[model samples]
Target: MSTVPLIRGYEVVIGLETHAQLSTRSKIFSGASTQFGAEPNTQACPVDLALPGTLPVMNRGAVERAIRFGLAVGAKVAPQSIFARKNYFYPDLPKGYQISQYEIPVVQGGKVGFFVGDHRKTVNLTRAHLEEDAGKSLHEDYHGQTGIDLNRAGTPLLEIVSEPEMRSSAEAVEYAKALHALVVWLGICDGNMQEGSFRCDANVSVRRPGQPYGTRREIKNLNSFRFLQQAIDYEVQWQIEQIEDGLPIVQATVLFNPDTGETRSMRTKEDAHDYRYFPDPDLPPLVIDPAWVEQVKAAMPELPSTMAERFQQEDGLPAYDATMMTQSLAMARFYEAARDASGQPKLVANWLMGEVSRRLNTEGGSIEASPVAAGTLAALIGRIVDGTVSNNGARQVFDALWGGDTDVDAVIEAKGLKQMNDEGALAAIVDQVLAANAKSVDEYRAGKDKAFNALVGQVMKASKGKANPAQAGELLKKKLG
Candidate 1:
């Protein structure tokens, strides 16, 4: 639980339902291809179209992915689960019903722990069940008519439901990001929001503190994190305004318009009974043997939390640094490679978090696409540690390295960025600086700390920015005494 701040004399409660498309080559119940960007209707087969005399068969890969997720989150993998038919009608749902889990879900009772700007928060998960996806409705190119694309029909999905634990939009975004990373890290989903591989629906409501929970409106299909935050913020304000104006908040399903940044009602909300869920006679009960679960546990990769703890104990990294390093598998591998090569954990962590991260964010690039390789970054850090370059000089070298330079030593030498390590030469430069800045030296002897910094700056300037600042400060202190 998080210590949520009150918004306008009311407490905002939020929960999220996320749909993650499983990374299977074929559909969940059919053999149709699941690749994206194909001719829309061409991918639909007889089973996907729900033609007469067709039956549904389970995809083993999809079940394995659900098991992997359950183990990762410490959730219970139910030995027996059943599927039900959720009755609904829409243009894209040719079957007039959806295959989903209602009573006994595949995964039950887990919690996702994440950080909201250094304050740790955990959101409890109610359930994560396997389901099939509905197709898309195309209206743009239909010339005032609507088109149905059944390509996405029968695609496997894991719908994860959370408790009403999140209290702020910022906290919700962090939780979403953490969930996205975990899915991608587990290789269960691609986690591509733009391609509709992952989507979120936020259930938002507001109430006076110490009162019963307010009626929640479900904001649907928020594909991006920015949109997720914006939709919740708008919805919370709208609910608060409605209550303050003496109007009751209606429970409904809403869609968020990204262009206008507002939510409009789609339909009145329906409870579980409205869907008329019942056991699907076509599909049998899904039963998992204990042996299969044990096999999966043996094959499971080290999870992020476990990896972060290992980084803290083995590499002597702080908890925050370790968590950041394990944000993705690629990032963790990069950090380890650089740390091992440089033999300096803290220095590598600082450079990665500060300079490397800034460059990646500016270019909208991932760690895998970074121009500087791990060995190259390690070489640069090595130079800084060996007194071959100052921190300022190292930045210059990094800039060149990022611009396609292959050799670190060559760049440092070619740009004359090496620090002045000659003891006699540095002593002479410090002596000249002390002689010139007589007033600053006198002020430093009289206990003015700023004066000492000014004198060090003068020495660095006299040495043409090649002086090691720490060494110059030591020499200045010795000469002044």
Candidate 2:
């Protein structure tokens, strides 16, 4: 649970419904290709088009992916689940209805844990069901006419519904990001927001403290996390303004306009009865054996939560650092490779979280696309550990490495960035600094700590920023005594 932050004296409540496009190659019922960017109507087979004398056949890959997702979240995987036809009339839906799970979904009762800042929070899930997606109605490029693209029709989807537990927009974003990472790590979804492989719809409402739940409006089809946060913020403010002005908040489906940063009503929100859900006569009930679940569990990769715990116990990383290291499988692999190569877990963690992360963010790249390799970074960390270079010098070495230099030692020598470790040379420099700053030394003898720091800075300046700061302080203190 998260601490609910009040917005203008009202508590903002939010939940999310996410549709993850499964990674199966074929449609959920038909043999049509489920690939994106295909020519319109070219990939829709007779079954997808709802032609006479055609029957729907189930895709086993989609069901297996659903099972994998249920197991990953520690949800209950029902042995038997029924498919229902949700009656809805839309031009893009050739069948005039969607096949989905209603009463008995395949996955139920799970939780997703994430971090908002340094606090850990958990959001419980309501259900995750399998469904088929609708086709797209393209309104552009048809010269005042709409074109229907059936390539996405009948594609496999897992609609994960969450409880209304999020207290703020930041919590909602973190929860969505965690769910996205899990699906991609489980190999069930591609997790590409730009390609429409993953989408989110947020249900937002606001209520006074200790009052009943407020009327929620669904903000639909948020493809980016930035839009998700912005939409919720505007929606919350709008609802509060309406209540303050003696206007009732209406229950409707809304669209987020990124340009204006507001939400407009699309249609009145419908309940389950409005769709007239009933068991589908064409498809039989889905059955999953206990043995199948066991097999899938055995072949599954290590989960991110488990891996984070392992990093904490074995490598002595803090909880935040461990969580960051295991954000994605590629990132975890990168951290482990660097930690193992350098034999310095803490140092490696610091660099990855600080310098490496800053560089990656500035370049708008992912860990997988990092220009610096793990081995090269590990070697740079080794230089700092063995007293070969100071922290500032290491940054210069990293800059060279990122710019295409391969040899670490060569870069260090070329820039003259090596630390001044010679005992006699450093002692002589400290003595000279003491003589030059006699007034500062007298101030230090009078119990002024700032004067001591100034004297050390003068020593570093005399040695041209190559002296070990700790050693300089020690030599300065001894000479003054």
**Best candidate according to lDDT:** 1
lDDT per residue for candidate 1 within 1-481, as digits (tens), equals 5356999989999999999999999999899999999998888888887789999999999999999999999899999999999999999998999999999999997989888877778899999999999999998978999998989999999999999989999989999999999999999999999999999999999988889999999999999999999999999999999988999999999999999999999999999999999999999999999899999999988999999999999989988888888889999999999999999988888888899999999998889999999999999999999999989989999999999997999999999999999999999999899889999989999999999999999999999999999999999988888
The residue-by-residue lDDT of candidate 2 on 150-169, one tens digit each, is: 88889999999999999999
- The 10-residue segment with the lowest total lDDT in model 2: 1-10
Instruction: Please identify model 2 stretches exceeding 4 Å from their true place.
Output: none
Error of 2 at 155 (Å): 0.7
Q: Backbone clashes in each candidate structure, one number apiece?
A: 0, 0
lDDT of 1 at 57: 92
Would you give me the overall lDDT of model 2? 0.93
